[model samples]
Target: MARGKEYGYLLDGLNSERAEMIKRALRAIPEIKSISIRPSQGTIQLIATKDPETQVKIACEVAGCVFRLKLGRGQLA
Candidate 1:
């Protein structure tokens, strides 16, 4: 299996303040491989070995906003 997977999330309610909260929430989850947040554009990029849906879900939940999937790239062999 691939060691990592990358996904992008477009969140509705993400700002500088809530971005920190989401960061903390993602950090607490071991399944998350990495996270990059763009507070200006309200975009979150994540690398995770687990389910992408779950990762996006948690991010939206923690940010208290609706999530729209912006991008998903499959692992290259």
Candidate 2:
């Protein structure tokens, strides 16, 4: 892995298909190795192993208004 940073996004009110679309969009980034999603406190937590900024950009592009990312845990590796 490149080993700079990992990205985490909190997605709310999204169905499985939508989540998969997000995942696919994320995978389009060549640096991203893997992605994991789990339900947390009424939101879906998306953890992706890649550059943090790149992940956030991808999330914003793909999700648009359907989800918002938590700023706290945004940087992880």
Candidate models: Cα lDDT each: 0.75, 0.54
Model 1: per-residue Cα lDDT over 1-77, one tens digit each: 55777777777877888888888878877777888888788788877887666756776786787776666454211
Residue-level error in angstroms, candidate 1, position 12: 0.8
Can you tell me which runs of candidate 2 are displaced by over 4 Å? 39-65, 71-77
Q: Model 1, residue 26: displacement in angstroms?
A: 0.9
Q: What's model 1's overall lDDT?
A: 0.75
Q: After superposition, how far is residue 38 of candidate 2 from its true place, in Å?
A: 2.2
Clashes (N, CA, C under 3 Å) per candidate: 0, 0
Which window of 10 residues has the lowest lDDT sum in candidate 2?
A: 39-48
- Candidate 2 structure quality by residue, lDDT tens digits, 52-75: 555645664576524465545534
Q: What value does the lDDT take at residue 22 in candidate 2?
A: 69
Q: List the residue pairs that clash in candidate 2.
A: none
Worst 10 residues of 1 by lDDT: 68-77
In candidate 2, residue 16 scores what lDDT? 63
